[model samples]
Structure formats: C-alpha cells, structure tokens
Target: MRALLLSLLLGAAVLPALAAAPTDPPTPPVPSTTDGLIAQPWYRPHHLIGQVAGGQGMVTVGVGYTTLRGRLDVDVLTGYVPRKYSITPMGIFTGKATYSPWTLGLGASRWQVRPLSVGGLVNYTASRGMNASLDGKYPKGYYWWPARSRAGAFVGGRVAYELPTKANGQPRTASLYYELGTNDLYLVSLYSNIKALSVADILTLGIGVKVDL
Candidate 1:
C-alpha cells in the first residue's frame, strides 16, 4: 500500500512538471498595421525633375501606397517655359492625386506676361481596366497687354501598365504610361486670343524604383 501511494505521488509530480513545461503560446498572428500596407514596392516616395527637349523644365515629388485591393498616389509639380523671343518666363505649379486607373490633378502657375492662374487635370488609365479622370483650375493674377486673367482648364487621358520584379528576394516594381490632353485659357482681353491650348500629343513616359520597408 505504501509503494502504491508513493507511485501515485510520483505520477502527480511528473504530470505537473510536464504540464508546466513552457508551452509556446500559438504565435499570435503578426498584427497587421498601416506600416505593413505601406511595405509594397510601390509605397516609397520619390522626386523627379528634368528639362524637355525645348528647354522647358519640370520638377515633381510625390508618394504612393498600394495593397491587395488598390493604390493611392499624390504628387506636386512645377514647370517653366521661357518666352520664345523675350526675356519673360512662363511657370506652373501643380498638385496631383490619383488612384489606380483614374487620375485627378490641380495646379497654379504664373507667366512673365500673364497673371497667377489655377488649372485642373483629368485622365483615364486603360491598361489597368476602364478608368477615367477629371481636373480643373482657376487663376488669381493678371496677364500682359491685351490678355485678361490667365485662368485655364485642362483634360487628359492615359494608359498604364505595372510590371513587378524582385531583386535579392525583395519586391520591386515599375510603371510605363502614355498621356494626351488639351487646355483652355480664359484670356478676357485679346480679341483674337487663343483660349484653347492643345497639349502636344506626345508619349509621356516615366520609370520608377520602389522598396519595401
């Protein structure tokens, strides 16, 4: 009887020790956060500026974010075009925000011969599906002789494709796109003034690099 009692005591001690052996609580699934949402290859912010073939220069800076569902991008741009024959300068500043497939943008600009102006842009992306965009702007300043307040409006469209890649086991992606558009200026003075400005139909192209954080 004593041996049996001792055996029972030993079993109890061993069972408790086994139960107390550190158990790895099931790893709580790693909490997901907005930080995770920003870890995509398209999430990093970037800055780009360059001069076109005609001596016109432009600068842009922006950030982008993407997830399994969709994406968002916002950017600011400033451009300058020197007068063809005079010492005056034409300048523009714009802020653009967009979602995949559709784009919306607004801008303010000035000219050596014109007043402060505001403008809007709208675009559609075709490669990603059926998407469309719309934008507008209003000028706050004056224009040169014979020209009224240089307020203007613009509309545009584009097609884009995102190519995904990997470098050293890290995610990387790039985008290719093309756009076309037209602009209208509200110059109240010039009797024969040209209000409609056609954006030279050109293939707007850009390449970007992204990193996951």
Candidate 2:
C-alpha cells in the first residue's frame, strides 16, 4: 500500500508540468501588413517604361521607382532624335520626379487611377557640336538657358490596369501615363513674347507606359 501511494503521488506531481509543456515550438510571427508590397531593397527600381516627347526624345526607354504606396515616382530615360528635331542628330537623357496627390481605385476591379500628378525634370542632349553650355560662338548671357540641357516642369495622369496573379505569387501590374509640360527655355520665350506665344505653343506632351517588376 505504501508503494502504491508513492506511485500515485509521483503521477500527480508530473501532471501539471506535462500540461504546461508546449507540444510545438513557438513560430516567428507572419507579418500581417503590406510589407510584402515593398521591394526588397528600398533603392531598387520598381518599374520600366517607354516614352515619347517631354524633351527627352521622340522615343525613349526608361526605368522608374514608386514610393509612398505609389503616390510618388521618379524615372530616368534615354533615346535618340534626328537632326530635323535638333541642331544635330543627338542622343538624349532625362531624369524626372513626380508626385500624385491622389489615387482612386475602381470598385472590385483591378483598375487604379491617379488623376493628377505634378513633376519636374532635367534633360541632356548629346550632340557632336553641342555642349550643355554655349560655345565661344555666342556672346556672354546671349541665351538665358543652356543649349544642350534643359529643365522643365509637368502635370499629368496615369491609369493602371492591374493584371491578375496566379495562386502562387505577387500581383502583375502595368500602367499607361501621359503628361504635358514646359521647359525653362520655352517659358523664357513665352513670357518674353507673350503676344506671340500661347500656352499650347510652349507645352510638350509625353505618352508612356510603366510595368511593375
């Protein structure tokens, strides 16, 4: 009877410890937020594009980044233009940054719209006889801005048609964007000759597409 009582006591003592022991090890928490939507490295580019006009080129290929949940963007593009469009046949490079204050999502659809965007850009044109600054051929301060490089401001819109993703991964996405803008030289000309120039005459239009990576 003593041995039987001792066994019963031991069983009772172990019961609480067994109940407290975890059957499975603890797991690291899965993030419940939209962190997955961000790129692995913050500085990595998020998109690529092809564009026309905006003083970069008649046609250009570019890369871009999106931030603030797609509220802001920046892009760099490069391309070629014929002598007919410039003083000489040239290669052009451009950098642009923009902010869209609002994005309106279409109901239950994969469409997202950024109805307004404002931005600025700088463009460099490489020509055989051309440099950003004027050559000795021109007197000092004859021209207000540089000859081979131009800076401009723009306003625009973008409409994105998000593609459906398969069960395995991230959502596919693409967008169409267009902008109208003016350069420093154009503005100088406009204000200097207001009677001869209209806003339409000073503005340049750019149409492009962006593909998310």
RMSD of 1: 16.4
Give the 10-residue window scoring lowest on summed lDDT in candidate 1. 109-118
Residue 76 lDDT in candidate 2: 88
TM-scores vs. true structure, each candidate: 0.35, 0.76
Report, for every candidate in turn, its global Cα lDDT versus the true structure: 0.33, 0.82
lDDT of 1 by residue, 1-213 (tens): 999999999999898878867774656544343222433345355323222211112322234344433233344444444555324544544444433433222233111111111223332111222121221222433332212111223222322222343332333333322222122332232224445432243223332223222
Clash pairs (backbone) in predicted model 2 = none
Stretches of candidate 1 exceeding 4 Å from the true structure: 1-36, 39-70, 85-87, 102-170, 184-213
Best by TM-score: 2
lDDT of 2 at 136: 78
- Residue pairs clashing in model 1 are 113-144, 115-142, 117-139, 118-137, 118-138, 119-137, 120-136, 120-137
The per-residue C-alpha lDDT of model 2 at residue 158 equals 93
